[model samples]
Target: MLGLIKKDLLIIKNNIKFAIIFIVVFVCFTEQSSELLYFVPIFLSTMLFISTFSYDDYNKWDAYACTLPQGKKSVVKAKYLASLLLTLMAVLITLILGFIIGAINKNFDAKEMLEIISGVVVAIVLLQSIMFPLMYKYGVEKGRIGIFLGVFGMSGLIGFLFKYLNIKIPNNVIQTFNDYWFIILPIIVILMILVSYNISKKIYLKKEF
Candidate 1:
C-alpha cells in the first residue's frame, strides 16, 4: 500500500506545471472564494481520474499493471488511494488559500469558510459514490462519461435549486454541516472507500487478463 501510494503521488508531483497553474488560478481569484473551495474536490477528483486513467490506457499499461507483483488489487487500491489523498489535499489547500484571501478581503468569515469546506466535502462524497462504482465496474474508458455527467449534472442542479429558491446565503442550506457531517460524514466516507477498494480489488482480480 505504501509503495503503491508513493508511486501514484510521485507521478502527480512530476506534473509541477499543472499544479502550479492550479495553485495560481485558485489563489489569485478573490471574487468567489467559497465557490473556489466548493470546486476543489471536483477539480482534484476529475483531474486525477483523467490524468491517471489516460496515462495507463494510453500507455497500454493495464496489462503491465496487472502483472506487477502487487497485482490488479494493488493497482485499483493505488488509484483509489490517490483519489482520496488528492481530494483531501485539495480541500486543505483550498481552505488555507480561502482563509488567507478572506483575511485580505475582510469580507469572508469563519462560518462562511466552514460552510465552504463542508459543501466541498459533501460534493466529493456524492461524486465519488457515483464515479467509483462506474470506474470500478467499467474501467476508465466507459467510466469517464459517468464521472463527467455525475459531477457536472449534480452541480448544475444544485446551482439551479439555489437560484430557483433565491437563496442569498447559499451556506444556509448546509448550515448543519458541522454537527451532522463533521461527525457522521467521515465515518460514512471511510466506510464507502473501504468497501469500494475491496470491491474494486475483487473485480480487478477477476477481470480477464
Candidate 2:
C-alpha cells in the first residue's frame, strides 16, 4: 500500500507548476498572516485531488492498476491517501514559507497560525464531502463541473457572509480548535473519508475493467 502511494506521488511530482504558483502567491501577497496563508493548503488540496482523477484518465492507468494483486479498491484508496499526504506536505511548505516571510517582517503570531490551520482543515473537509462523491459518480471529465461549482459557490457564499451579511463568526473556530473537539474532528474526517472510499470503491468496482 505504501509502495502504491509512493508511485502515485512520484507521478504527481512530475508536474508541480500548479503547486509552485500557490507558494509564489503566498510570497507575493506579503501579508504572510495566518488568515492569508490558510487558503494555500485548502486551495492546493482541492486542485490536486481533482487531478487524481484527471491523471488517471490522462495516463489510462486504471486498467493497469486494476490488474494489480491489491485490486481496484486499493487503487482507489491509494489515490485518496496520496492526496491527503500531498496535501499535508503542501500545508507544511506553506507554513514554513509563511513563517519565514512573517519572521523577516516580524508579523507572525500563534492565533493567526491556528486560524490558518483551522481554515485549511475546514476547507479540506468541505471539499472532500463535495468532490469525492462527485468523482466517484461522474469521473473526472463530468465531475469537474461539480468541482467548479463547489469551489465558486463556496467562494461566493463566503464573500456574502463575511462581506455583505456581516454575520461575524467569532475566531473561536480557530482559536480553540483543539481545546475541546480537536481529536474528534480529525476522527470524523477520517471516518468520512473512509465512508467515501467505501462508496467510491463499490461504485468503481462494478465498472468494466
Candidate 3:
C-alpha cells in the first residue's frame, strides 16, 4: 500500500511543475483575486491525481495489480490516502502563497484567508467524494463525462427549484451555518470520503479488470 501510494505521489510530483507554472501565471494575471490562489492549487492537485487513473488504465495497471495480495483493496485505499496527502500539500502551498500575497498587497487578513482556503478545500473534497465512486465503477473517460453532466444537471435542478418554488434561506440559518461551518464541514467531508471509499472499494473489487 505504501509503495502504491508513493507511486501515485511520484506521478503528481513529476507533473506538478506545469501546474505550478499555470498557477503562477494565474496569480500574475489576477493579483486582485486571492481566492483564486487558494482554489487553483487544490483544483489542480485534484485534476493531477485524477489523471493518474487515466495513466493506470492506459498502462493496464489494474489488471496486473489484482494479481497481488489485497491488490484491489490496496489500490483503492492508496488512492484515497494519496489524494488526502496531495490535498494537504496543496493547502499548505496555498496557505504560504496567501500569506505572501497578502503581505505584498498589504491587506492580509489571516482569518479571511483561512476561511477561503477552508471553504475551497471543503468544496473540492465534496466533488472528489462524488466523482471517485463513479470513476471506480466506470473507467476514467466515462466517469469524467458523467461527472460533468451530473454537476450541470444538479445545478440546473437546484436553480429551477429555487426559482419556481420560491425557497428562501433564512438569514438566521445562513448566519448559523457561517458560525458553525468550520466544525460542520469537516464532519460532512469525513463521512462523505468514508462512504465514497467504501463504494469505490466495492466497485473495484467486483470489477473483472
Candidate 4:
C-alpha cells in the first residue's frame, strides 16, 4: 500500500511544475474572493489526484501493477487513500493561506472560513464518489469525459431548478449545517468515500488487464 502511494507521489513529483502553476494562478486570481479562494486547495488536490490516473494510463502502469502482490484492491485503496491524504494536505495549505490573507486584509471570519472548508470537503468527496467508479469501469480517458459531463450537467440542473423552480435553500437549514458540520459532514464524507471505494474496487476487480 505504501509503495503504491509512493508511486503516485513520484508521479506527482514528476509533474510538480503543473501543480505549482495551478497554485500560483489560484492564489493570484482568488485573493479577493474569500469564498472562491476557499476552494483552491481542494480543487488543486482533486485535479492532481485525477492527473495521476492519466499518468498511470499513459504509462500502462495499472496492468503491470496488478501482476504484483498488492493487486487491484490495493491499487484502488491506494488511490482512495492518496485522495484523502491530498485533500487533508490541501485543507492545511488553505488554512495557512487563509490566515495569511486574513492577517493582511484584517478581515477574518472564522465562521465563514469553517463554512468554506466544509463546502470544499463535501464537494471533493462528492466529486470522487462519482469519479472513481467511472474511472475504474471505463478507464481514465472516458472517465474524464464522464466527470466533465457529470459536473456540468449537475451544475446546469441545479441552476435551472434555482432559476425556474425557485427552489431556495433556507437560511436556517444552512445555519443548521454550519452549526453541526464538524460533526455531521465528516461522517457523511467518510461513508460516501467508503461506498465509492467499494464500488471502485468491484469495478476494478471485474476489469481485465
Q: Quick one: best TM-score, which candidate?
A: 3
**Candidate topping lDDT:** 3
TM-score of each: 0.75, 0.78, 0.95, 0.88
**Model 1 lDDT tens row, 37-145:** 5565457645765576667667767687777786666777777877778777877777777777777777767776776676667666656656666775787767878
Please provide, for model 4 over 105-183, each residue's C-alpha lDDT reduced to its tens digit, 9 standing for 90 to 100: 7888877997889888898899989998998898898998999999999999999999999999999999998688798
Whole-model alpha-carbon lDDT for candidate 4: 0.86
Clashes of each: 0, 0, 0, 0
Model 3 clashing residue pairs (backbone): none
TM-score ranking, best first? 3, 4, 2, 1
Q: List ranges where model 4 is wrong by over 4 Å.
A: 25-32, 161-175
Each model's lDDT comes to 0.69, 0.73, 0.89, 0.86
Would you give me the overall lDDT of model 3?
A: 0.89
Model 1 lDDT at residue 201: 71
Stretches of candidate 3 off by over 4 Å are none
Question: Of 1 and 2, which scores higher on lDDT?
Answer: 2
User: In candidate 4, what residue range of length 10 has the lowest lDDT sum?
Assistant: 27-36
State the number of backbone clashes in model 4: 0
